[model samples]
Target: MIMRQGQQLLLPANPLFIWFSLIVAMMLNMLPVGRIPWMPDFLAVVIVFWSVHQPLRVGVVAAFLFGLAIDVHQASLLGQHALAYTTLSFFAITIHRRLLWFTVPSQALQVLPLFVAAHAIEIAIRMLAGGSYPGPTLLLAPVLEAALWPVVSVLLLLPQRRAPDPDENRPL
Candidate 1:
């Protein structure tokens, strides 16, 4: 939706939408695209977005819990995703205010490091547990997640972005 010059739409952010999107992201992560199971980390992207934009609604605990759910669902090492998500949330919370000052694309650029950090945590966990590297291809997930950031922001904000009033013609 385009806004005329000096026009701004300030729709209230609904907490429900935040929670619903997280659940959907979890389900999407579970879907198999191949035996590789290398889907973009949608949960991380969503958590970071909400943690940055709606900190009160989605926080470290939520990120930890969702990460645990993903861990269990994926049958991976316990607490791996949890640790990564919690750290990611912490970073998001710390950066949220600064993030608000930038445009979405710039925000995504800032967030790219967080996604990489999350993946680094995951890799470190695996290495500590004696699990072999999943290969260089594993690195692609974060890049894809970062690339999807702007798209996610736009889609998630659509509900909150009010369209210009069509009733401008109505009088007085």
Candidate 2:
């Protein structure tokens, strides 16, 4: 069924959009960093927006798969990105409802902390699992990812917040 513009689809969606987005994100990740290897993680930012706005459509499972893809592509420890993606998706999904109430600026505020905490977990897990944890540089992921979050979100139509309601604490 063709969903008209601005209307949310109530039925099962085709996998094309999700798969396309995932591929785009992965491709972006594959780009050479040149010198700044610590630049923002485009895939993580993309998945975070999807998880927040379309939690049912994108979740930890997708993140895990993407993580695996990145791990293989980058030849990192098998589960580094997988662990990071799963943890990031979990955080985004849990607070997604409230995020809708936030304006883009407020959403920025919400995302910054979420990104930091999520990456910290990934860094901690990577350290514990088997590899030598990179020093403080791991913390940079959140800073860079948060900076890119809104830009990534604009790639798609903004997902609807909760259905219209009176007395909502709308974003300021």
Candidate 2: minimum summed lDDT over ten consecutive residues — where? Answer: 157-166
Clashing residue pairs in candidate 2 are none
lDDT of 1 by residue, 1-172 (tens): 4444554465768888888999999898888775462468999999999999889889999999999998998788999999999999999999998887778889889999999999999989989999898888887888888899999998998888764454677421
lDDT of 2 by residue, 1-172 (tens): 3434555433333457766877898898888765253567778888888898779989999999999999899877788789888988998999988887666667877888877776676667766877565667667767877777677666554332334443658421
Q: What is the lDDT of residue 159 in candidate 1?
A: 86
Look at candidate 1 and tell me the lDDT of residue 2: 48
Q: What lDDT would each prediction earn against the true structure? A: 0.88, 0.74
RMSD of 1: 3.7
Looking at model 2, residue 3 earns an lDDT score of 36
The C-alpha RMSD of each candidate to the native structure, in angstroms, is 3.7, 7.9
- Stretches of model 2 off by over 4 angstroms after superposition: 1-15, 34-37, 129-138, 158-172
